[model samples]
Target chain A: MHADPIGVLTGAHFIDGDHACSEGAIAAGCRFVAGYPITPSTEVVERIAERFPFVGGVFIQMEDEIASSIAIQGAVWGGKKAMTVTSGPGFSLMMEHIGLAAMTETPCVFVDVQRAGPSTGLPTMPAQGDMMQARWGSHGDYQIIAIVPNSPQECFDLTVHAFNLSERYRVPVMMMMDECVGHMIERVVIPSADKIEVHNRKVYDGPKESYRAFETGRDLIPSMVKAGDGYRIHVTGLTHDEKGYPDMSVSAQGKLVQRLMDKIRIHADDIVMYKEEDVEGADVVVVSFGITSRTAIPAIEQARAKGLKVGHLRLVVVWPFPEKRIRELAGKVKSIVVPELNMGQIVYEVERCAAGKCNVVSVPHAGGTVHQPKDILAAIEKSLRGT
Target chain B: MPRNEIKIGGFGGQGVILSGYILGRAASIYDSKYATMIQAFGPEARGSACSAQLIISDEPISYPYIVAPNVMVLMSQEAYSKFTPELAPGGILLTEEDLVVTHNLRADVRHFSIPATRIAEELGKRLVLNIVMLGFATALTNLVGRDAARNAVKVSVPKGTEELNFAAFEKGYEYGLQLLKKEPEKILA
Candidate 1:
């Protein structure tokens, strides 16, 4: 469906990534937002607060990140697209609710403008440290979708995709923006409302008395109904049966938990997205994402200049790991080099995917700033020497 | 240009970030080029030495941060002292005459000065001083077009102050042109 006209800022604008992300959320029909202000991520909610009044939306600065995270799920259940924005420290505080959202199968988006570290380290700098956290932060066995945006334009474009994916699978989609992309300003062209595609939650239209909130037919996803829609529905974090009531049987646990896992695991191919360039007949492939992807370009060009067959792979969707593509490249290429702002997070995933078919070299950094192109070039050079 | 990294520095509330925004908007939105601006975000940005880094290129900018700025626009003494050591050799330096005191001038870099604050005061709003410096930059750097810079200034400034800002811009632009024409050797040296 087309976006709402009032929320679409259709023009060429010189804006920062934070503001672009807010526009993206609004364009995707996100009318309710609850967030606690945090550095590098504050501008996102600030812009939402300023623009919500004009776009028939609501922005609430909750008391804390835990409240802010769950409030978005509540808004989602109320028939409104909603999101929350935060950074490293605040993202840590919202982990329990993220698991709650996963267990309850709530549709919402969590934007984490990642900064350096384990505990509030380098609050104003860039880091890809939250990559593993986005996928595994929430406790227990479930799957989630996360997209990393490299530019302000992608910040707008990918955010809408995050909302669409969340609504499609009734999962919490993480918009993983780093401090670099979050603060950098560039020209972002927001298209007209009709040109943008938005996904709305699937609402049930069956008999109210016989409504089953957890029943799945041919499709793995179940249709949803709002709280006041004259339907007898119950949602919870417990392992429940198809009838929406708590079930203690091992079979019930298996059915509910397996569906939650299969909904994303079975649809992994559709969820995995990446950008590949010059991979054919290449001896080495450089895998990177977010700010590191942009920083790796000059180094790739420099490698090409030195008569090396180097290819580039940039991850748009960091979760689901693009294992198929990585395995294919590993079979063809002699080695794969993964560079990131963190010491080593996603690189482990690439290594696992490579699986001894080719050598996997990780170029790691501790995370105050982005990687230097020369460092990536050096890694590429080293990988070639081994082969 | 292959790429030009420009650093605009001053204390907060002097519109240091706004000037970078205008320059980036002019290059990207109006001039059909790519520009990326990254502002310093820390405690210093509140009331102390704040700066904005911009990279302008004919192609899409990949490396967003500035390594060594080839163009430095300084509006405060603190910003000048903190940032001048990193200016690229044979670069362009534009400074406000009243606000910044020129010292330890580099031989390879070209220097140009304009009393942007005085011009903005003459135009009846000191807040438009950044616009004045922006106009001077449009003339000195030749990185952005005149019409593009003018349009960006109009679009970026607050409503009801377009007239005053334009006058301030024109004063700086004319002053830059006259200085270049009158003392090409001294400034170029």
Candidate 2:
């Protein structure tokens, strides 16, 4: 069923928002997609359901978002790169599973197409309000990878990256996309299959009796064993021991929780991805992501054209947020202008990273649309003057 | 490598964006002029102001949206008023005459007025005016192939509706050719 099993497949054609997202899931070697039909995200599943049958995979429209997320969690354990997409309201329901994926250290991808919302504010309109929620909505102390792509093309490309990051480091990944990016049509080069590096979960080949779900050396990432395998795999939500048994003993629970945190915290650099632009001899740096980044690109050029000596940086990987790079720039640049859809989600990170070396000023707007470049430039110009 | 930046704006359903994709695909896929297209949606998909920016560069282009487009195709009066000022010093603005009937045209910039909505209404669909505008757009700019644009329209149009789309484009192209005949030096000069 794989067409070009060794090389990236090539077929240039026009596709809508939903199908493009599904094609990204397929190219990422996603074997399972569990999602319920909700307006913006429904097309993602509908396309996956239609395409999965032909590609030797499964797509189930679960009863609700909770069931959908749980089914995807099961599929990931069953040795498959699984995904589930949901809109704003549906996403509200899957917050618990999002926390579960993090707590259990399960490697799976979840896509949340951000529609305007607090609670289904506007299903069709786009919003980046999910920016703050994506980082902290899932309760508990756990690090996860969250990427937001601004275009239909980025939607396709980033989903592939989400799967790669999730597998490389055993953890859940979230992809944030909005209606403008999800619904808008664009020309995206469908990558060849061979070009995509597929990573499967590590399995313990030792004696079935000796397999442990949460026991590894200094790295803290353990080898996983499927349920049907001869290895007895007992994975529970409760804080467990290296032997997969819930040990409420202080030392056992403390060791278990610390290791889960250490695995991601130690490898933060490897997981974060960002795009740095025109920092040489610059005063104000504009930090942006998602649809707002598109506008920021032009604003950066305009700032440069106006001789403001400003640069631009974009965070493709929003979680495990690029604190290192931001810290490095905060010292060099006069000020950092963060223009996002929400009031102050990502800006909080920029401010923390700044640590008073440079002021982190935020320019945000939300409701139905994206932040304009002119407003971003205005911020950049203001930052330049203030500095 | 010179990048041909084409800016299009109009109501959403007029296919302003489809024309951008058709032009990009034709030049990049078939004719081999590296192309990139961008569209910013309005809050409302149907009535709000919609725009598509197309770039055809021989070399790799870094920036996606053009701040000052080389060519501007305005489908409505509001689009014309919104975009005409943003055209780079030496740019052209193409407006549909039937709907945007205007006498206060800019003298510094080259302007062509085509009755696209009038032409499409004759073909029994107002949405096809975007195709007619594409005809006028391609005729004015030398970025994309005439044949490739036609093929792109073929791939873009929904099943069985290809013939009407083709006829609409052909009539608009012929209309553009006749309009160019009146002042050949203006376009060529």
Candidate 3:
């Protein structure tokens, strides 16, 4: 983690973007993958389709996005951690089932290697257009995890993390990748087998007949009863009680929803991840995510060369928001500029954290391209002058 | 310290990528300085002008691009047109005289036109033209050691293929050393 293997790992060969993400999933112990081919994301499935047979995993190309999403659910229920991969239009079709996974509290991973669209804008170009949708695409009130990575290497490493987080928290984890990072090829070190950490769903070791489906633990996430154990365990998408029976009562639904949200929200500090650089004596800070953040590195150097004390706060893990750190940043810097490939998505989060302690500006650009370094530098220069 | 950004451009078969990678490996594995090589892969990487950005620094590299380079190494005519304009003001341009068949008279840039492709044929391997030009680039910037660049070249290639490439690289080095000792003054300085 300290080295960012893409920058330091000289061992891996220079391969295409698709192969790297596939290797990462294999390393994460993915036993099942269901997908239908899409442009940039197709390579992910192709590489996995080739590798799965050798690794003893199931790589199924379901009829379409609907079946693709369901196959992973069936595999997960069959007691294997699973995943499905897709792009924008495919993702829209899967939202119904995304909501289903939420309701069932089924653990699986969904990889959306995003291309531009409300309805297929650019099939081959890159866009961060899906950021907001990832947080809200699946219908209804449910707590889930979505993490974004800005490079092919993070695409691999974070997919592994996404799987681990899903198993630990018992929820569907969404991996958000834009076309830029999806296509970019950097070095990806296949870590040694002993170096990899894999987490499986917690199984109830008690007597088979005694197991109850919705029984709570300290974290409020229930332990699972492996199906063949002869446990008459009930699972459902409907609002359920501790014994897994439908609860039509308003009070019971309230308690159930609160606990589900609390399981992740209360322990967010443990889940949030971000990186801050050169902030010791800075008056201006640039906050960015995904592809735009890669460009910010150059802007930071340019700003530093001009003798302006500017720093960077980059998001490696987007969800659960990393609120505490941003609030701390709000107190120190005179202003913060959050640049994204969107109009004002993540900037809103930064503004909320600032809370009038300092100025927050969204230096935004959207659609198929990234913000060039000079534009970001211009914003930093403007922020430094208080204009 | 301010780093040097060098952009190498040519059509796909010209070994533009190999040239950039050798420089990156030199700065990284051999010299132990921070370096990065980010290339754009396009349909034209084979026929049209292909390009790659090389950054070598005493500190960690920030920009993955070479927006304006301290050096421009042009292997083809299209490459010369596409990238030569972004040469850092008063920077040096090392190019193949024939590949850049048409010459530009830009007084601001110090141009050293070498017959690199013709020299490669004379040396018996047309593929080694990039290795030859890199000899000139390393000699100019000295950002990464010449020996480091040579070693990076040797290791990158396949077994048994290394011997001829080494000879090709030596021809390039001999040609480059002539530029150093024979020229009136070091333009990079």
In DockQ terms, which candidate is top? Answer: 1
**Quality of model 1 by C-alpha lDDT:** 0.91
The clash tally of candidate 2 reads 5
Candidate 3's displacement at residue A159, Å, is 3.6
In angstroms and one decimal each, the interface RMSD of every candidate reads 0.5, 3.9, 3.7
TM-score of chain B of 3: 0.91
DockQ of model 3, rounded to 2 decimals = 0.22
The CAPRI class of candidate 1 is high
Query: Best TM-score goes to which candidate?
Result: 1
Ranking by TM-score: 1, 2, 3
Predicted candidate 2 versus true structure: per-residue lDDT over A62-152, tens digit per residue: 8999999889989888888899999889888988998888877789998888888788788777778887777777777677789988776
Per-prediction count of colliding residue pairs? 0, 5, 1
lDDT of 3 by residue, A220-308 (tens): 88887656667786777788888778899998789888887887897788778777888778888898877777889888889899998
lDDT of 2: 0.79
TM-score of chain B of each: 0.95, 0.92, 0.91
